[model samples]
Target: MRLALFQMTSGIDAASNGDAIAAAMDVAADGGADALLTPEMSLLLDRDRERAAVRAEADYPEIAVLRKNARELNLWLHLGLPVKQGDKRRNRTLVIAPNGEIAARYDKIHLFDVDLATGESWRESRVYEGGDAPVLVEMDEQEVGLSICYDIRFPALYRTLAEAGAGLLTIPAAFTVPTGRAHWHVLARARAIETGCFVAAPAQVGRHEDGRETFGHSVVIDPWGRTLLDMEQGRGVGFADIDFAAVARARVQVPALANARPIPSPVRRGMAAQAN
Candidate 1:
């Protein structure tokens, strides 16, 4: 499947940001993309808690348009982290099929609460509630695992998805500049390698109108842990054609999933050794 990973800077204004996302989706469609992916906080990305929550309310205009547009254009759409209808906001991803039906939804499972060396402090949990369930969405002829920015840090999550029979994983993010630079590619590739699944991450880049900066290197990695496409650090849309055959090939050769060995606890091992 040919996919387009869109990179853009999102701001606090929901309407304007919606327009931008719509435009980007159109471009992806024009580029002959079968599926178009956008970044986390695709709606309103303001750090100011009250302001952001207020703006985040409602079925975001962009998602509604993208869903309609996806059905019209016959392109599969996967957008990240729109605030859903709830007293507590949930960072979420919505997958819209070609016919404009809501196929699957994945919430951002891991909250990014960190204090950076750059003196940037983020408390994602303050605004967005962490999701309890791991989302493995079904797309055209494939089982696609779903995650958001912070969830990629946890490898066990990817393993669960793979064990659940996901051939591909979608990780849409608006990772901070510091963290994104340090661990984005490495972790993304690691997940793909560990799971033997194709990983696609479309990210937010640069500073937004709200004065928040993001690290934008939208990447697509094959099951063999090779990067098929990287958007780098800027505003851009990276496109690539992914083949599920590669996933099968990688898993067959490595077969790490089957080779997993179970061992006793550390204390049990020590006792057994002493007894021996």
Candidate 2:
């Protein structure tokens, strides 16, 4: 299947951002993408949830427009954690089926709350509550796992998804410039390697009007942890065709699942003293 990852740079205005997403969908369609994905905050980028609250109102025009556009285009679109949720904005992903109906919704499990040494700080929990469930969607005759930006850092989560029989994992991210530069590619590759599944990461790039900058470089990795497509920094589309056969092929060769062994490797509390 041909998949497209939109490397977008989000703006502060929700309406304009929505329009950009629509346009990107068109580009992906023109490029013959079977499925398309956008970065996190696909509609708006703001640290203020108080303002984002307005997006949830039933009359909010942007959501309707997005739904209408998705239905019209006949594209299976994945909008990554759009800001325009509801009274309580969930860092959520909306899967728009070809019929225009919302096929599934996945709220981000791991919030991006962090304090870094470079004077960079994020308090996502203050605005958005984290989601706890894992979402698996039907796609390309296989199950696809859903995850967000910060969730990629957790290895156990991906392992669980793989155990659940997910062949593809999608991570739509608006990674900060600092973390993205340092760990984006490595983490994406690691997730694919551990899970033995194909990974598609659509990302945000460039500086946002809110004074926040994102690391671009959207990536797609095959089951064996090789990059199939890499979108260089900035606004654009990256494409890669996944060979379903390869998914099984890689797993059989690695035999990671059959070989996985779980044994206690960490320090023991009282056991260390008993040795003395």
Candidate 3:
């Protein structure tokens, strides 16, 4: 399947961002892409709770437009992370089928609450409620696992998805410039290699209206951990032709998943000392 990843520099205005997304979808469809994936917070990238809260609605207008576009273009569309109405609001990923129907929704499992050494900080949990369940959607006879930005840090989640028969993993992110520069490609490639699955990461790039900058090297990795396509630090579309057969071949070569072993409970410190 041909996959197109969009690297965007979104801002506080939902309408403008929606137009950009629509235009990207058109580009992807024109390029013969079977699926189009977007970066996190595709609609709005503001850090202000008040501004973001005002736009949070269950039936967001952007979603409706995307649904229509998906149907018209006959493409599988993944809206990276859109804000949803709730008590604390939700950071959600929506998968739209070619028929323009909602296939699945995955809320961001890990909220980014960090204090970086560079003095940059974020408190995502303060504005958004985190999801406990991971989501996997099946498309074109292949199981695709879904995750958002910070969720990529937790290897166990990807392992669980791979064990559950996911052949492709999607991690849509609006990563900070610092973290993205240091660990983006390394971690993304690691996940694909460890899980023996294709990793498609659509990312947010450049500076936004909120005075925050994002790392924009959107990349697609094959199961063997090779970077098939990378959109290095720009606002544009990156495309890669993905073959599911590569996933099967990688798993067969390593057999790591099949060789996985369960761990026993840790021994108490006192008990271990006594035994020694």
Query: What's the TM-score of each model vs. the native?
Result: 0.92, 0.91, 0.95
Give the winner by TM-score: 1 or 2.
1
lDDT of 1: 0.84
Q: Over the full model, what C-alpha lDDT does candidate 2 score relative to the true structure?
A: 0.82
Task: Write one digit per residue (lDDT tens) for candidate 3, span 159-220.
Answer: 99999999999999988887888999999999999999999999998888988988898999
lDDT of 1 by residue, 1-276 (tens): 899988988888877877877787788889899998988877667877656644353445666777788888999988765574466778888888999988988877788888888888888777668889998777888999999888999988998899899999999898878788789999999999998999999999998877887899999999999999998986756789999999889999999877877756665457777888
Error of model 3, residue 95, in angstroms = 0.5
Give stretches of model 2 more than 4 Å off.
49-54, 57-59, 82-88, 261-271
Q: List the residue pairs that clash in candidate 3.
A: none
Q: How far off is model 3, as Cα RMSD? A: 1.8
Every model: Cα RMSD to truth: 2.7, 2.4, 1.8
Which residue ranges in model 3 land beyond 4 Å of their true spot?
53-57, 268-272
What lDDT is obtained when candidate 3 is compared to the true structure?
0.89
By lDDT rank, best first, the candidates go 3, 1, 2
What is the lDDT for 181 in model 2? 83
